[model samples]
Target: MPLYVWLACGLYWMNGMATVVLGSVLPLAVQHLHTTYVFGSDLVFLQFVGYWIGVPLSSMAVRRTGYRGAIVASSAITALASAGFTAWPKPLPYLVCSLANGIGMALMQATVSTSLIEWFPARRAVIMSRTEAAFGLGCVLGPLFASACIAAGRWQVAFALVAAAAAALAVVGAFTPMAARDSREGPRDAHTDAIHLANRRDRALVLALFMLCVLIYVGLESCVNNFLPAVFVEHFGLPATTASVAVSAFWAAMVAGRMATGWIARKLPYRPYLILAALGTLCTTVVLAATRSVVLGYVECVWLGLFMSGIYVVTLVFANHAFPDLTGLVTRLVTFFAGLGGATLPYAFGWTLAKTGSQWADVALALFAAVLFGVVGWTGWVTKRKSRSPSERVHAAG
Candidate 1:
């Protein structure tokens, strides 16, 4: 890996840090801002809207501006937005700030995903795993860090900290090697191909896999992360603090699982690896519905997290493999599905919980798992059939 890769990783770590902090602190923010819980979630909704909106276009910007430029732009935007959160006067300002952060994050995400996939070709899984592990670390630490910062009684200081981190990262990334890929030189994975979502070796399979992975991973993560605390409090008879612990363990286990996923995918193809992960998630989600024991229920949430991590990354990685010549294109398309999934499912899960018992959470999980299983199987089958014949592979890709 180049020094730039490491630097980009650092920037990405900090980038992810603020993203996690902002997302996790929504409830606290709502209280402090004197808004309803609806405002809290609307923040997530708006940010995701920005994210999904930028998914396709950011890759193009990276193509035009170069990877280093893309990263710098994303970092600057995110840092400024984080700082804006502190001084912004009202909910409208917060929403706009989040939207800006989301757009910058999407661009940065694409830049890093494109750059890192190329940096460690032989160790794709391990390298990507390490990157995701960093994201997990950010997710785990952001909430607690924000809490601590808030306790210090100056919330603006927290935003300022994120801004400083972003600016510093941007400086480092600007100096780092970008592995600049030119058209007609590097293969699909190396060039603007990551942006060409439609040109993978097995286009049909890629589409199906992308849809499945995004929906399943995002849905499950949002569902459990957002709503499970309430479930534990109500169904499992746990105190709010204990219930909160379940959410924490979920993220921690997700980080661990992502580490394991990267390690696992190195040797095994993502197809089966993702299948196993989804199956594991399905089993535990079912168990969550059945468990009455408070402690055991929280433990199941940990298992849920363990199974949740890396499934989406696997989708991105494998999609890159299918369209190695155009990873940027496919990565964006896949992530768009993933991001949309993340945005949409939490609402569905919340609705389910409100309308039915906590068992409804299991139902949602089951639906997500089922869709993913179907997509994976179909995509794998199509890819397998195409690989058997060079003409078929070429034709399918074309």
Candidate 2:
């Protein structure tokens, strides 16, 4: 791996850490802010608002500042916003901070995903899977740290810690060697250029499929991560500490799964691997929804994480490969939808929990998984149908 890859992974780790820690501390945040649980989850919503706002600006930021500079700037923003968490019991200030954090996340995400192509052209799938594993590792660790902070009655310190870490990452990112153009502006592949020009409709269909897949998956995953701890506490009557541990286990499985996926992607066909992952997600979510025992629920959560690990990265990588010329555009579009998902779904999850019941939360997640399975399966059908057209032409000639 290059220095840029390490820097990118570091940013992703911090991104994951901050997002998960916010979820883990939701109970405290709600109480401190004097809000309901549904409203407390708005912290996740606001951050993604900043993310959506930053997506369009990220392209210009990267162009002007260079990838390294953009990363440094975004990291600084993350640090500043995280420090704002110290203004606890004040909803307005905290919401403002969350919005800032989302913008930072958006800028960094766009730059890192785009830069990795230049960093490793041949091993894109493997690198992306591994980089997401770094994110999973952060998720695994961040909640435990947050739990400890909560236990010590200094939950705000977790935000301070995130700020300090981001500051350090910004410093490291400043020294990394990444070009302003990221090698995308160099030469064009005539074959790819021709393909993009000729197959406009196919390209549109593929892009649409990927964007929708990313949105639904991100929404489902965010809802689970943001609200799962609350479900455990409110429904199962578990302590916050125990709930945090459960979240940790879920993310630990995600780390392990992504590592495994990086290896498997080398051996398996892309479509089949995706089908298997979707199937696992669907099954695990069902079991999670049905199980009543807390121990069984924890085990199911681990499976859900493992199954859900690489879908977003794979989707991003696939879109990049499909349309190399539009790397930045595709990155922004997919990421924008993803941020939109993160912004919307957690609130919906909270709303469902508030309106219907906790049991319905799992049902909602399962439905999302089912939709993912259908969409992936539909892509394969489209490919098969398209493949048959050539044979049909031959038969007509015969």
Candidate 3:
């Protein structure tokens, strides 16, 4: 119920929204900026770099300067960067602004991610999942709104709108309180909590299992999310717009799935819920592989979104409980690679599809699904075996 928590949530939404919002309109931005589409996408590359480097740095800064300063600074920087993108159409300005925005976004995600873990530890899964769902909502809303601006040929106007919106977030965040980083919570118990969270019921096996599951989950989901438009174009011989709608469905399903996970996490522990989700994902992948219908592809996309909504967050939950104190460090490490996986997987999927056919992509999905099952099954067995022990978490990290 703290004001900083509210502010952090708002920033979380903006950062999440902005990152996804650009994906839909990157091609448009490139044309408008008088640069290669690859140049505009360089923004994403820079953003990834920022995310890779800036998150841990921001966490360290937050430790020293507090989230209030870091959050406000990041917001202002991002807003200004976005404003520049809107106002200045030249290539240099565009790349500069874009990379700055990337830096700001990375700092914002890292600082806020750590702040949230601290703010709502007792309900980490539900709270994180719900807040993240707002991000999923942003992924849809940002492009939807921007696409409208594009229809009017007002790309700058759209960037201006996002800029103004981000600036407003900065204002509100400036007024929010810094979270309690005080040690009245005690170093001993804090360290204890971190340990209890880190050591899984099954020692090192759970982390290994979770990471494998995540790698597969991320691989297939990213491939589909990244390439659905192209797939629809080739497979169904549809217009780009038609394929885009399917992409929208994927994101919307992701939002819905996150909401569902938040509700389910309240009822189930990490292991069972993920098992069911992975299993369901496996079934959907099977259906997708067997069918050649474009409609079925869309349906498969929805189910993929459903499972993915929780996959990363669930991994985060497992990580947090198993590694509380090192949460930021661990998050940056894992997410950096996950981001790498997501970025690269799509091209691989597309390349294979081009060489062979659309059917090969399903093999990738099914392979990913199989990986998830192996992960979930192994984790379940390990977790169950160790439930009777006095402590569940150990320091075995994957």
Highest lDDT model number: 2
Give the alpha carbon lDDT tens digit for every residue of 156-201 in model 3: 5656766877899888887766755433231111111122222444
Model 2, 1-398: lDDT tens digits are 55676777888889888878888888778887778877766777888899898787788888897777888988999999988886554888888998998999888887788777555555667777778998888888889998999899987787877898899999998787774333433222111111232377877887788788788888888887778888888767898878877788889999999988778766765666667888899999888778889989899889999898988877776667667788778878988999988888777888787677778877887887898888877755554444445557479668
By descending lDDT, how would the candidates be arranged?
Answer: 2, 1, 3
| Candidate 1 Cα misplacement greater than 4 A, ranges | 34-36, 149-161, 180-202, 225-244, 350-363, 390-398
For model 1, state the Cα shift of residue 332 in Å: 1.8
Q: Give per-residue CA lDDT, model 1, range 74-189, as digits (tens).
A: 88888888889878737899989978877877778877877777655545566677677777766666555665665665545557777888888888777766664322322122
Residue ranges of candidate 2 with Cα displaced over 4 Å: 179-198, 384-398
Q: For residue 26, give model 1's deviation from the true position in Å.
A: 2.7
Sort all candidates by TM-score, best to worst: 2, 1, 3
Q: Give the CA lDDT, 0 to 100, for residue 95 in model 2.
A: 87
Candidate closest to the true structure, highest TM-score: 2
The whole-model lDDT of each prediction reads: 0.67, 0.79, 0.65
Q: Name the weakest run of 10 consecutive residues (lDDT summed) in model 3.
A: 186-195
222: Cα error in model 3, Å: 4.3
- Model 3 has how many clashing residue pairs? 6
Q: Tell me how candidate 1 scores on lDDT.
A: 0.67
